[model samples]
Target: MIALHDAVGRLSAALGGSPAAKLAASALVEADALGLPRFGIAMLDEWAADAAPVPETAGAQAVSWLDCSSCFAPLAVAGTTLDLAGTARQSGIAAVFLRGVRGFGRLVPFVRHLADTGLVGIAGAEGPPFVAPHGGTRPVIGTNPFALAMGRGSERVVIDIASSSATMADIKTARMTDAPLPDGIALDGAGRPTRVAADVAALLPRGGQIGSLLGLTVELLAGVAGAGRGDAKGRGVFILAFDPAAAGEGIDWQGKLAALKSDWTDGGGYWPRGGALAAGTMLDGDFAQRLDTHLARMAGQAGC
Candidate 1:
């Protein structure tokens, strides 16, 4: 398994990043090291694609208070990710509309942090239009990813997903495995179905037509809602945090959720980390080697 510190050092040196960037990068690598993620690729591509731009602070116009707050941040997503959690702590429920942000990375880690801070998080983001439309060939909408996380006593559960049938990262990873695509996962450059990952040019939607609908819906919520002035920079995410105690359920609300989870498991079975832990992470040598080479290249570019 890749040590978390090593991953952080490599990513930080590669990006010349902030603490938040380093933390997010480390999580991305760890997730990939564990397995091919159901969500997508690590944020390293976004970071290494270009040197990080100077962050644009959220001016007063950034905050718009209605039932919650919306922040238009044309900058990094990490600080705002934490800021929303704190806002929830004070506001009972807070929404952060992060516009023009990049390197959204993994939602699980972000929401897990919010959960640890005693909050429930709902988040989504829009990235470059890498997926072709449901009935069309050319790319149009983003993968449209979302995540939900909640705290349960001393435990936390995070669920993350991308609306595409398979993410761009999935195709790239599949290339490494030399595996054929599933029945309806991707389309080739010629707009025909292809099983070979390397030949695939665009991804299809998840759940067939349903994923198509949901993908657009996600963009509406996370992308259009907090529409930014500039580019997505490969990542534009929005997150909302809610304080469960705001419902006047008291501090034991997490206990209630945890108990419900136990009941669900007792009834039959559920895939959650309530009392169990994952089998130890088994690092893939090829993945680690390729990842290291890419990071080393970025670091060299950064003069690290």
Candidate 2:
């Protein structure tokens, strides 16, 4: 296992000491600690490319937007979410939209952060086309991930799911390990069911029509938010947060939720809760080797 501190230092060195680099490095580590390695250090190269040419931002009041065509998505999204958390606390609810951004890894960490602060959080993003629409063979929708988290304190229900039958990360990971893809989740270039990850042309939508609609919803949200941007490719994301304290004495949400958790657990059902980031965690040996290779490659390129 690679030490957590060692991993962070390597990533930071490869990324340089910019503020964005620091954030991205920390986020990747956090993702791994949360057991979401798909969004972890494996994406260092992608994040490095997106971390440049800082994004343009514009907003006022409860609604704001970001133009992240050439920006580091993790940094942009994280900064925006943090800002909106404060807004939601003061105004009950707040939302921010981002367009032209690339993959920003998992949304769980961001929403879970809000949940930790006693706010209900929701986030969704549409990426490059990889999933087919309902009853269609052609790839037309992104994985279109959606995540939500809500609870009083440490006991929060967090859900993060791809609207598609599978995520691009799943395909990439399978290909890396030379493993067969799961049946029924993906199609080949000819749109035929395929088990070979290398042949994957498109993923099926999750839950059939329901997942298709969810992907479509993300597309529309991103479309409207990035309406005027020439670089907009319908790749957009939005984060929303709501503070219960702004309710001014309504239902006891905290108490009700606590009771619900008890009832569900007592019935032998596990809660879909978020886990805290384990800062002292270690990475799998294979994954750590891969990261070291990436760092070495980057360093060699820098010397060229």
Candidate 3:
């Protein structure tokens, strides 16, 4: 635990120093990097570019929201997302819309944090369009990521996904290395399928037509309806939360969940959310050396 905390401290130090507007966003993302290993991501550079996408100056305004049980609300660029959790505790459910901020990267830790606080968490977020609709020419919708988390005793089940065939950040890294992308991940500027990283201009949604619909739906729900950003400006977020106790009068939620788990075969799970957490997370020796070098160089540039 100390080792983990120390690593996170170093990383957060390296990622700190953003303008007021994006300061909250930068902190959230830096916290996010600490849990990458739990999901099998061993390299910090996975999301780092020439430099991490930290903010240098405040975007526009401070975050603010409205008071309602279940309503669409807008959040300022540096608005406190914790406000959403507070509203959920009061009303038992809330659907929050975030505006002027597009810093959402992964949904697991964010939602899990809410769940751990004794609320069921569900969220969807959309940013600038990088994923094109299936069979469409140019990119229209974002990757449209979504996440869900549930609290059970001391355990929290977390699930998150990007509707795109491939993650936008990974593609950016691939472009950095001039490496080829996986088949069917991205299309060229001319709307033609191509694996060459440098040629990638738009990404494809997962599952062809179906995934495209999900992606578009999230864009509408989060980007347009939630944040009221019809042009898909900045990051748009939609989050909902409800208390399980208030939801069910006397249901044995944990018992039922345990029974369901017993019915399933042992070791059966899905990616990202699935997988043995007890499993040791390690990178290849050569890759580890490279990562250390990269971190040292970044730390120096960060002036930490």
Cα-based TM-score, every candidate: 0.70, 0.78, 0.66
Q: Which ten contiguous residues of candidate 1 have the minimum total lDDT?
A: 65-74
lDDT of 1 at 36: 39
Highest TM-score, which number? Answer: 2
Stretch of 10 with least lDDT, candidate 2: 226-235
lDDT of 2 by residue, 180-228 (tens): 8877899888888899999999999999899999988876775556441
Task: Give the per-residue lDDT digits (tens) of candidate 1, residues 1-304.
Answer: 4554565566655554765556456556556655634321344544444444434336422233211112212224556666666667887787766555655446666776677777887777777887777887876778887788887443466677778988787788899999888978888899888899999888888877788887777787766776731253334567788888787855687777878777877899653531212335445666667668767766665664
Q: What is the clash count for each candidate, in the order shown?
A: 2, 0, 3
Candidate 1: where is the Cα deviation over 4 Å?
5-22, 35-75, 133-138, 153-155, 173-179, 188-192, 196-201, 228-232, 249-252, 267-269, 272-304
The parts of candidate 3 lying over 4 Å away from their true place are 6-81, 153-155, 228-233, 265-267, 271-304
lDDT, residue 38, model 3: 21
Please estimate how well model 2 matches the true structure, expressed as its whole-model Cα lDDT.
0.76
Hey, what RMSD does candidate 3 come out at? 8.2
Predictions in order: lDDT: 0.64, 0.76, 0.57
Q: Model 3: per-residue lDDT, tens digit, 63-108?
A: 2232211211111322234555666777767656664443434555
**TM-score (C-alpha) between model 3 and the true structure:** 0.66
